[model samples]
Target: MAQIGMEQIGVVERVWRYPIKSVGGESLRQADVDERGLVGDRVYAVRDARGKLGSGKNSRRFTRMDGLLHLSSRLLSDADEPVLLDVDGTAVPDANGFLRSYLNQDDVELAREGEISHFDELPVSVLTTATLDWVRAAVPDVPVDERRFRPNLLVRTPPGCPPFLEDGWPGRAARIGNVRLTFVRSCVRCVMVNADQPTLPHSSDVLRTIAAGHDNCLGTLATVAAPGAITVGDTVALESQDAL
Candidate 1:
């Protein structure tokens, strides 16, 4: 069997969690990681009439209701109740009404997914600054923001390395802080990447560039192997396959 060599690749530059799926995410200095990924991440989602979780994939619901991205959600207190905030930072106590008004859809409902929340694929998504820089360089016309990718952890790769290096990390194990994660597969790009963020307009070229340059994948999906706390500035290192 081929032995995999491990090395220190980068530091965790940013940590983000989305209390509600398909909405804005909140940056964190530290977070608890468990089998389901970062605690309180994607704990809630809007459900449509067919009992489908509202997502950018189902363009009929998400595209028309894309305004959900303009809203921000936060989990408050020990109860972990999600509090919705409008663009003006005004508290919206009525989540259903707020979603209904913003999405302009009467059938949609906002609800919690409890312990095992709704996830499009894997529990955690990881991205590298190197990959982002590469995408920006590949598509100069469109604005490339990290928010468009919605990654859980943004890693700052070591200096003087090629972009998309993480593409070869599948089936590999990585250690971030005290937590260990096993890479599952490349995260497939969706129309969500092309959706407009706060001030940025929707640019299809973002996904187009990814599809053309990187096979429509930019980051890697991972699952937690060990539960622990992770914070910004944490060192990231890949585990040797032989060590397993």
Candidate 2:
């Protein structure tokens, strides 16, 4: 048998779920894992009047997409109903309010899709604390918050392990207990990273820093290979199938 080495790093300190795209995300103490991904995850998205999906890409023209911010459920609580909040103290309960507050134009025409809220083209997104720290050092001017990256899983690993090294781990698999997830591609970031969480102003050089160091491909995207629940303290093990 060939010897395989695995390193156990820090635990998942937080779990965030963006119920609706560009609207806001809810933080959770714990979440159920399924084949599709995390339960109540990107299950809702914002759509324009034409029934087309709206994202920071095209919606950047409107400051709402850039000005407003959303976080995961893990960061919020039920007492804070209408979980989505803006920098100006405005809050919304459901999609309707979110559209109104964000779009700004009363007749912009918007709706929320409840059936499926997919993010770009990936099933799961992951990031690391070390990577964020590295980028912050590269560009002292940019404030790189996890909310900006909007990742599903944020793993904290050793200092020098490439931030998005998961890119090279493609075809291999990682396990958090019985749950297994396959690393796919790197997550491509956008102006959303520059947008302030509680303010409307935009910051530059955020993506530039990422491109400089961690642009291994884009960002980190993954998919669930086996269904099981994951938590903050769960230990993750990365294993290559060829060794088996």
Error of 2 at 16 (Å): 1.5
RMSD to truth, every model = 3.2, 4.4
**Model 2 TM-score?**
0.78
Window of ten residues with lowest summed lDDT in model 1: 56-65
Enumerate clash totals for all models, in the order shown.
Answer: 0, 16
lDDT of 1 by residue, 1-244 (tens): 2124667888899999999898888889999999989999998888878766776666533434567777778877576778888987677979888788788788888778855448878999999999999988877888786899999999999777788878878888988888999998999998889888687678899998899888899899999999999899998888886655
Q: Report, for every candidate in turn, its global Cα lDDT versus the true structure.
A: 0.84, 0.61
**Quick one: how many clashes does candidate 2 have?**
16
Native-vs-model 2 lDDT? 0.61
Best by TM-score: 1
Over 4 Å off in model 2, which ranges? 1-10, 59-64, 70-83, 86-94, 107-117, 159-162, 199-201, 216-218, 241-244
